[model samples]
Target: MQARLDQELARKGELIHRWSEGSLHEVDLIEEDYFTMLAALNRKVSSLRESIASLEGTPPPRVAPEELLANWTAGSLHQRRAILKRYLHSITVHPPLPSSQFDRAPLVKTRLAPHWKTAAEVTA
Candidate 1:
């Protein structure tokens, strides 16, 4: 709704340039400007809603784990040598998942927070 209004205002130069030029109710623009915009935006929104409704009833795509690993192994070689260099950039040992026994946050906090300065801090 807000987006449709914004589109209408964008197309109507009267609304855009109204401040200095000062013509809010120009006869030609007021008659056809905002309505045309609302119609087009309504169509777009209707189609997007229809797509969402259709997706709600559809099953998602699936990948087999063995196939994924095989594809990755084969495709990695065909990729540019630059990618090989990039892929070997670093091997990092991230902290284990956060745990009451091991860390300050929940066990599922798998990501490290920024500002961990020392290798010792991470390794600890």
Candidate 2:
């Protein structure tokens, strides 16, 4: 098992569950996948603004994703900053634990329960 990956995912999952009740919160993908979705949404929003500008006489310049999320349209600066900062942090600097730590062999039925064994035996 990738310990770091599992820990990151569990942390993200807990945050998502506590803050959101949407289907997206129940999603089972990596943080990278979530960030990619954010990027896609940001791109689509930029495209929409360009389209709107062509229709309207004048539309203001599009904002960068960080700034846009940092200053959310429907919320206070405190809420916006907190949410955006967490989102941005989640987007970067996450690395999975090494695969060598994963248990690869089929689980064998042993005479004793796992808890019955010594810690050293468990490590072995």
Candidate 3:
């Protein structure tokens, strides 16, 4: 993806060079095409970077658990969601069967994020 972005950037540079040299007759059309391609390439690069970041699972900046607890209490919904996404890989909820006793509790499981697993292994 990075290579593709680099290639597209090089192509854009070449297009501009041609336009500057007055070699391209349809300058307006070429400019339009170049910008369109650049926008799409930029979006692709951004998406690729996000995917790489997720896969790498680099730990977030170190903060005290107390700080996080405070944030959870005072943060906006968006902020809270961001924090949860950073720390939790997933949550699975299993509903109780209708035939099961009413006293039985539903099953809930939570998986920590990849970074947490790495930290745990290091500590162990």
Candidate 4:
């Protein structure tokens, strides 16, 4: 869409230049068409710029941890899944260690999104 608009604008500019130099055959007709085409091209470029601005605007605000945990505890399955998908990169589960070591061993590990970096990591 942007490329087409640029091409049309370039063509209109060339026509205007030719009309100014008295090279276009129909001066009055070409003048009217040139201005009309220029207006339409300007409108299209403005609309495209607005569309791009909307897309480039700030992203959705991050969910707070306390609110997120509360939602996870009380939300429906779908809601919980959505939160997990948005914030967590992966989860790894490990088999239980032998009885003697099980108490001290970790069973699951989680990788949260980069935006959720800890205070220590942030300070470093």
RMSD of each: 21.4, 21.6, 15.6, 21.4
State the lDDT of candidate 3 residue by residue for 10-40, as single tens digits.
Answer: 6645654665576776645664554455445
CA deviation > 4 Å runs, candidate 1? 1-28, 58-124
Tens-digit per-residue lDDT, 1-124, candidate 4: 5576467557645755675677775545654564556456545654654555556773323335764565455444665666566555565555566777555433432222234434443222
lDDT of each: 0.42, 0.45, 0.52, 0.53
Tell me the lDDT of model 1 at 25. Answer: 58
Q: Which lDDT tens digits does candidate 2 get at residues 2-108?
A: 34434544554454454344455565765555555444444455455556556675653534565554336433455455445544423232243367754435323
- Can you write out model 1's per-residue Cα lDDT over 1-124, one digit (the tens) per residue? 4465345435433433552254645644562454444345434544544454466754322224553343344332433332334234443546675454576555344443333234333222
Models 1 onward score TM values of 0.25, 0.33, 0.35, 0.34
Give the lDDT of residue 40 in candidate 4.
Answer: 61
Query: Model 4, which residues run further than 4 Å from truth?
Result: 1-56, 104-124
Checking candidate 3 for backbone clashes, the offending pairs are: none
Model 2: pairs clashing at backbone N, Cα or C within 3 Å:
1-102
- Among these predictions, the greatest TM-score belongs to 3
Q: How many pairs collide in each candidate, listed in order? A: 0, 1, 0, 0
